[model samples]
Target: KMFACEHEGVTPDILVLGKGMTGGYLPLSATITTEEIYGAFLGEYEEFKTFYHGHSYAGNPIACAAARGSLEAFRNNDTLEALKEKVAYFEEELKEFEGLPHVGNVRSKGLMAGIELVVDKESKDPYAPETAVGWKVAEHAMEDEVLLRPLGNVVVLMPPLGIPMDDLKKLVRVTYESIRRATEGKPHNGNP
Candidate 1:
């Protein structure tokens, strides 16, 4: 919201938000749209044009309460402001992985990052699905006590918003080590 509304000076007509809304507790989401968009749905009920879209568990009070709590937590901690140093450190630390042979790309925004591993670094050919490249790196990371979740062939690093500096560095180092182990010419299914 801040990035779009302030940084880019853009206002979206409609915004659909979920996942973090309920603090990952109950499955609930909300759609917020401009008055102009809402006006489009302002037809007579007799015309049966009332916008209708919802889930069974929509507007659950418990979930809403959790979401409120999450918001409060953010406000109390000023989480974004506090995470600046940590985010920068995480980014700088990620630079080391670029030297690795199979590291195709290392992209990041704040705390969310992805390290793309490639079979052919020059051609940027991604590993086969059977190779499970991303998962392999995550598996190796887990061995070093760094929990990782990969998005397909990109090993995604989404640490907690306010993770400690030490932990964030560990995450970077563990991720680099993991990618190295996965792509250092080790045979998977005897496909050397």
Candidate 2:
């Protein structure tokens, strides 16, 4: 299904998009289709067959305005180009912690990243769930004035798209410190 839907010359009958569509400032999504699809329901008044799906905020003017402004800013600032460079730098800097004593893996795409912690690097075994290693690391990061959230045993970083290089460095440093503090004096047979 995935391959067929994504392959060349194969167009989906309906396209549903969500998440980051409005840069996550508001809750909104869209179901887009071609004019042909819409024409199928265009008929006489008595024969009208309109779909019935609604949200209280559907067609919200404020959200539409925000989306337009965000798109404009993206184009005016060449945000995609800038992100291409920034993401490359981010990935390189993030990888530096790969062999840290408690760090298991670093995975990143664009400006989003996840740092996994492990109790045994060779075995790639995660710390006990009850240990709350990820949660503790996030708390320590907050203490350092950097916010992070944990997904299971992985610490996820979703920094803003246009974060400055200096700030990015600070983020990496803070993450390292957070991990160290969270696991300080604890025995782990990981990266060492």
Candidate 3:
């Protein structure tokens, strides 16, 4: 969303925010409508024109209170501005993997990043789906204490907003080492 707003210059008419809005402290999501769209839903109550959507815990008092506190923390801490700096450093730190074999593309947008693995760099040939190459890297990364989520051959990194630089660097190092070990001919445990 930040990438779309800042880099792509796009503004959404309606936005859906979820768990991350409360920093995962509660399960909640909100569908925010633009003024124009919201106005469309507005009419005389007698007209029977209304949008009714609710969940089991839709307006739970505890959850709503926590979410408000979370939003205020973000505003007070200047989280967004601080995130830009961390994202820049995180992207730069991962440059260590650019020269590694099978390291195809390093992509980052705001605090999210993905390292795409490939069989042939020039041709950008991805590994076989059944090979589970990304999973291997993620499994190996856990050995180095950095958890990653992989989509096919793309290993994704999305650290928390408050993670320190040293920790982020550690994540980068672990990720690089994991990919390096995963792609090498010699196996880490000598199994294959």
Candidate 4:
């Protein structure tokens, strides 16, 4: 889906988009709101209801061009439409981690996913922060030339939208191996 809210059938009052706005080519952000909300700020000169907001790069032309280019590429290449197969493959590949002894949860949307690691699957107990279990798993992946970032005990996987199937498979395989090396056969008593 283009956005998660659209898929959930919820309309947001305000939507803030960044990061992928320019496909990481430049820093750009956009705030979108319904026209009804925007019109509320309009009034006579004395109404004193003007919304004043400013930022250093608020309207940078270079960033705007990059954002436009990203949108054009999305439309021309049918990016979202093309993701159907990839998304299915991603979901299927992610199933491999579900039965792992240390995997607490696997959540995904589009090309982004998070694998939550736990001390005990039955109890869903989290490892102590100092244990850095997530970081250890990431390190193991890095050894195989696959970069990963951790959110506490959750290892995040956010690959590029245009990644090939072969690379996606490798990403999952390396991540699975990393988790195994980091958690399997290890005591989860909470000490690093």
Predicted model with the maximum TM-score: 4
lDDT of 1 by residue, 125-177 (tens): 98889999888887877777778988888988887775777788778877777
Ranking by TM-score: 4, 3, 1, 2
Model 2 Cα displacement at 91 (Å)? 0.8
- Model 4: residue 27 alpha-carbon error in angstroms: 1.6
What's the residue-level lDDT of 111 in candidate 4?
Answer: 88
TM-score of each: 0.85, 0.77, 0.87, 0.90
Could you tell me how far off, in angstroms, the CA of residue 93 lies in candidate 3 after the best superposition? 1.9
Looking at candidate 1, the ten consecutive residues that score lowest on lDDT are: 183-192
Which lDDT tens digits does candidate 4 get at residues 1-192?
A: 788898799999878898687888888888888898788888987998786755788889999999899888888989888899999999998998999999999999888999999999999999999999999998888777899999999999999887877888888888888898899844333211
Model 3 residue 90 CA deviation in Å: 1.2
Clash pairs (backbone) in predicted model 3: none
Model 3 agreement with the true structure over 43-128: per-residue lDDT tens digits: 99998768787789787788888889988887898887888778888877878778987999998877778899999888889999
lDDT digits (tens) for residues 3-94 of candidate 2:
22453667877777644556668777778778888778778778856766668877788777777776677678887778777778888888
Off by over 4 Å in 3: 1-3, 185-192
Show the colliding residue pairs in model 4: none
lDDT, model 4, position 179: 92
RMSD of 2: 5.5
Give the lDDT ranking, best first: 4, 3, 1, 2
